[model samples]
Target: MTEPGGGGRTGWVAPLCWSAVALEGFDLVVLGVVLPSLLDEPAWGLTPATASLVSTAGLLGVMVGALSAGPLADLLGRRRAMLATVVSFSVLTLLCAVATGPWTFGALRFLAGLGLGGVLPVALAMVNEYGRSGRGGSATTALMTGYHVGAVATSLLGILLIPVWGWRAMFVAGALPALVLVPLLARYLPDSRPQPPPATGAARSRNPVAQLVRDGYLRSSVAFWVASFMGLLLVYGLNTWLPEIMRAAGYGLGAALAQLLVLNIGAIAGLLVAGRVADRTGVRAATPAWFAGGALFLALLAVPLPGAGIYLSVLLAGVFVFSAQVLVYAHVSQHYPDHARASALGAASGIGRLGAISGPLLGGGLLSAGLAYPWGFFAFAAVAALGAVAVLAVPRAVPARAR
Candidate 1:
């Protein structure tokens, strides 16, 4: 039988942790889906450059949040840290609906990004703690499925609500879950075990970057960061530009959007399959292979093929593209000690945010240059290949219990 605080509780822990990530996913993609609506508003007067700036600002804020939250969670406890982040982002997102101009909107997005950034690491830590030994990969995969689920929900919202209620309504809708989950988290969530109670009762020093560079960990930390950078670049870039890329490949709008749906469906399936596969094999064994497959499939993304062939390739690419990066996060949890778990996750995510920032901008540049489809697929393929190498070289840093 499972103890009260044992891994069995991961069922609840994983879902609760996902609530925050779900909110992030919802907020992240909803902006893209709603951009057309924003452009139609004369009051906003948003140029493409101005709109891009707003996105950049939000991404910068997310990187800051991801980098900073590690230590804070280390000091404050994961549950409380996550709750604070959720509340902060939720309120700020609501405030976004009321913003009057481009500047205000961009500023609000940046502020919201802070909350968005921090919540992910904290939630990740919670799931890792409750996860069974040797099951860290599966645990993280399960939690991150929430991200794709959130994205799926936003797409549905765009179809159902955007036509009637409009874009601002999307932000308002994003706020509801935070309000609902905040109280539930406060009531039911358990604290992560403290990190050795901060030596001699002195104030805690919780810098993830600094700690990661310390004795015996520097090489692994750098490897993971490199892997994260490439993995997320492929993820964000593909999601941002897939429709445009597909269109350039001669698919109609209906087909392009259908590809998006297909991609995410494959993503959901990949997450479930990856968790099970990684649990049976090893995260170390599975991640590099997945990234390699992602690279191969992405390379074929823009090649003209028969309808059935295109569908199968896109589905396969989605499976590997989304899940390969997730496996990276899973590996981080398994490799790190409990005390540094959140920090490790935070650092990987924080660094990965750089790629997130670059992905869309690069895709847009390619589109403007009229090299849209082939360039995007080719670039993503290269990044995926790099990810394969970076992850393949990861030393057997798995923790004793995790192994």
Candidate 2:
């Protein structure tokens, strides 16, 4: 069957998918934005340890959502899955505004995380399926720029809203966009056609996860998982704690939050650049190079710099750090067959959430020890280097048809 919006009429696909990803991006940085305020609220009794636990709870939910959503989307249809996820998360996020305690808030976050986690792979698969032929790299990165666009907006909103309206306002604001977004999705988003049956009868019966490790795909699958873990470690660790880290480094809260804003702004710029470069140089070469650049910039963040110098450093770090993770998704989409593409992306994202969980814990631990500044940057830099090395192991080849 011909896919809906195929034949190069995918205008709706990009905007709807991009908007879905933007919501996920809002969740990505919202907690970090409100974290400092939460800590200051005496009634909640939140400490670094508890905050990390809350963050972990949310990430754990995301991991489960990602792992299950891929197969579910493959079975039920992407349009239905996307709409369900958006509604589920938006309602849960709105409830977060009324959470009575940290545990209650954490529970809501975990519940909302389930929907947030599912959005990425599902939206990604849809975009790739309907995207311009042979521009998978650009297509993937372009969609992801919405991720940072939302994040950048959240950071700015936090700065403006949190102080005046309080921390709960951020959650309320995060969910409100979905009201407009969901209607657009339900009205315009088209369901993707199911993948054709496998060539062999035996292969046809096998599930998406099994197809990942079979047929000479084990090495690439394993490599993608490892690289994704490290990439997300950097992405989540910094987004969740960079403002606090900057605070620990002696900057005021406003300046620290501004740094977070700068970081994602740089991420938007990086995503735009990385896509074109990856498309031109080949994702295989470009992915590793971006990770390596991320490592270098992350390590540079350890150095103490003057005001302008520090913002520039954070911007550079954002440029390389965030897009490095998205490139992994681009690479996976190009390497895998359509039959198992969402499954592969989901598995990679789900496994990467483990690193996402660890990222906050790592930062929380460092902050608790009063070593968040130099040490956190060093630790994050090492993870980026590992990401570079892991992707290097995934043999330099895209499927013939994919290319």
Candidate 3:
């Protein structure tokens, strides 16, 4: 009997790594949920603008962390890198509960972001290695489903606990995985790294990241980075401003908020649908199709249809926009050999964070200029279409050798 991750290994590693991804998701949602209370307290001095800065601060740290993860994962094995990152973020998240002011809170979140940003690529690499028969799409999509699950769980916790225990307790909840997951991962997860053939010896031990763009991989590598940029830009932009965008279009506040919930529900449903399709159709084909669908659904949002029609559009947009990006991750995992896999993912994810930062900023800018609604939605549709074009630029065949 053979295993997908490696021979003679139990199926425990993927779940352990996935739990780390979920922890980051939980920690992320906690910040979003807690910010309102922080603003109301006044002691924190969290103006909406300052709160946005705090958000960007964490994202910047995540960008740095993500950029570094690939190199570090290449230097240290994936399991070790994953463990260190999970511990780093979880411990820092606990520190967030004790912060004295907005600056301190923002600083802690920034530091925690380093750990949060670093883990996903490593985890995705592990899951991709664990699965077999080039099922990168199904495996990665299945793993990312844990992210939304973690996000929804934190949203529920915010509602239940923040009112009683307050926001600090919520951060504390985000920290619990350190105690449970770190040990579980150490015990259960097998190390994943590429095996350098004996022929190369000392010569082959060059930078893994440099291998991504040399020879046959340059075109695909650039295309993947650009596609990831567009995908995440759409994701963060819409998640941050969707409610506000809808309200600007004249929908009631309650309906706008309800649409967010519907969107996330659609995201969860889309992940399952996409995983199966990507597994069969191949990520190269499926990812672009999803993004194309996202563009259409998003463009339809500008029309202000009746209640059911609007809900359907929101749901469909949610389905395509988020999963389309994850499909790219699937493609990357399948594209690179095992050794360079984490580095490739980390680079792409790091670049995508730029888009994440831009999305909210772009929407906020448009809102300030009174151009948010049709223009914002139109811009989002255009970006999704651009992502599809980027995907199409990926080379049909990339050399299998690690350069």
lDDT of 2 by residue, 98-150 (tens): 99999999999999989988999999988888888878889999999888778
Candidate 1, residues 85-114: lDDT per residue as tens digits? 999999999998888888999999999999
Per-residue lDDT, model 1, residue 297, is 93
- The ten-residue window of minimal lDDT in model 1 covers 1-10
Worst lDDT run of 10 residues, candidate 3, spans 1-10
Q: By TM-score, how accurate is candidate 3?
A: 0.95
On residues 1-403, what C-alpha lDDT tens digit does candidate 3 reach at each position? 1122322244786688778888878965777899888998767767988888889889988888888887788667777788889989999999999998999999998999999899989888888877877677888998998888899999999999999998899889999868988877777777665653345543443567776776477788889999999999998899889999999999889999999989999999999999899999888899999999999999999887975999999999999999999999998888876667888899899999999999988999999899998999999999999999999998888654534
The lDDT for every candidate, in the order shown, is 0.83, 0.87, 0.85
Clashes of 2: 0
Q: Residue 77 CA error for candidate 2 (Å)?
A: 1.4
Over the full model, what C-alpha lDDT does candidate 2 score relative to the true structure? 0.87
How do the predictions measure up, each by TM-score?
Answer: 0.92, 0.88, 0.95
Q: How many pairs collide in each candidate, listed in order?
A: 0, 0, 1
Worst 10 residues of 2 by lDDT: 1-10
TM-score leader:
3
Error of 2 at 259 (Å): 4.4
